[model samples]
Target: MRSLTGFRITAQRSGVAIAGTAAALLLLTSCAGSGEPAQEAGAAVAEDCTPLHEFTTIEPGVLTVAAMNAAPKFHALSDSGPFTGIDATLIPEFAAENCLEVKFKPMTGAAAQLDLREGKSDMFGGLILKTPERAEVFAQTEGSILYETLGITSAKDAAYDTVDSLQGKRVGTLSGSYYVEPLKAAYGANNVEEYQSDANAFEDLKAGRIDAVAWQSIQGFNFTDRDDDYVTKILDDDQKYPELTVLLENNWPHTKGNSAMTAAIDDYYERAKADGTVARVLEENEIGEEAAELYVNGR
Candidate 1:
């Protein structure tokens, strides 16, 4: 027992020294000072911070944009096999800025909103109006992308002068559109004849089955260009149609989270508005003389 205490104390001191050395090594490694170059350590920290930059930037996959393909505003070509409109022009620019590829999907009738809600498309690019009900499912931009004036198209010799004047007349409108409510309220639901498409509605107006057709002024004017049988006049005169904007939902059914996508889109829209790309697209699509004014005034 004479030397047992000395041996035990020496072994305990050796064990404590080894533990402290291991702890020091760990601290040095954590501080990135384990004999590694400073630049390499900085790079490792940067790689960890910017995780999004690691993905392939080649295409960023496809962003499907839904359109009604209604001509002057939107149209899907059979030969081209896709849609084109003011939205078509602007979307590519927006996509380019965000490093994305775009694919256009043409839809008709009442399926436009359904396609977006069902996650069939990434965005809806036509002249969709903003409403409290619509906001429940979609996120809208702060300012309008463009302004469209709703008007009535009638036969050149028709006698209607005001919305009230068409109280008993048959008015053609595209079914399930925001315009339906106002037209039904103005002319009574019984007097309003609903059409599946604007093309058919314009056709009926030309055929004299309907006394007037309600449509966007610029779009209706463009339609009249294609067919000379009708004359277009502003319906409300004060240009009260809802402001058209690009639409994207808060959450798409296909994605688990859309915060990053929405942020990218918002940044793209802001930059486009600042650099005049948006205005150029509107002009190239022949929106109207009043488009720039309307956009600036937030109407």
Candidate 2:
């Protein structure tokens, strides 16, 4: 008998012609499903025929993953080393399955996309939106690994509730962020102000240069906590933005080669959903309350 990954099979003949014929016959037999019951057919086999673990045989390599330094999601502490949010925990499991290694990089909010575009990073794992325009530059994975709700924040004395309310007021946001589009659509392109980074946007917002700032709920809350003068408020019903997706860079200016990565990402989401790991991560982080519930309930 011959052994491959601990599986012992009769070594009938070790010739190219014999191997080819055996391969064809095995394919044909597999396609022709036996009429016997599955349990009965399995019981008839003398060898222990259970399939080997699917993940162990994949090729091993290092993959660079990028993320913006956002707390409770993806961030680095000078003393604590690099860490991830829900998406981060899944990376090790995925890598173990694929026999790959991961190297994490923290890019500024503005430079994250540029890093991927220049081939400096293999993927970004965070709340990235998949826009048609961006698809030209990168490939997007199927389904959002997490959901983010947008919120508007202002001084406690500021009065605003709806998207129309922000019409003439200056709104601050980070450059190259998904919030830019929604803010532009709601408050006219000119009314939306872009900053180089989230810290800069928060600074401008605190300086009274901008009437309000629009960002993810977690970030909005974090900003408010960091500054005493700022007040965080969830955007009104009319101002809420639709859910967006995270995208990964593909082999662009070449042929489309990120299909495999995209497929793997989709499979990751499916497994995460089935096992409730997604919900657990959200709940542990104390963000995305609604999404966590939906994921936990198997929605």
TM-score of each: 0.67, 0.66
Question: Could you give candidate 2's per-residue lDDT for residues 122-173 as a string of tens digits?
Answer: 6654456555666687777656565444556788677355556677899987
What number of clashing residue pairs does each candidate have, in the order they appear? 2, 1
Cα lDDT for residue 133, model 1? 55
Deviation (Å) of 72 in candidate 1 = 1.7
| Per-residue lDDT of model 1, residues 1-299, tens digit only | 00010010000010000000000000001111111211211111221222221223212444566565566455554323333455555555444333344555565525666666676666665666555555566655544555444556777677354666677888887775667777877678998898766667776777779998875554455565444465666533423322211111111111214546555555555555676666665566654545344433333
Q: Which stretches of candidate 2 lie over 4 Å from their true place?
A: 1-60, 78-80, 225-229, 236-256, 288-291, 294-299
Per-residue error (Å), model 1, residue 216: 2.5
Model 1 Cα shift for residue 1 (angstroms): 99
Q: Report model 2's TM-score to 2 decimal places.
A: 0.66
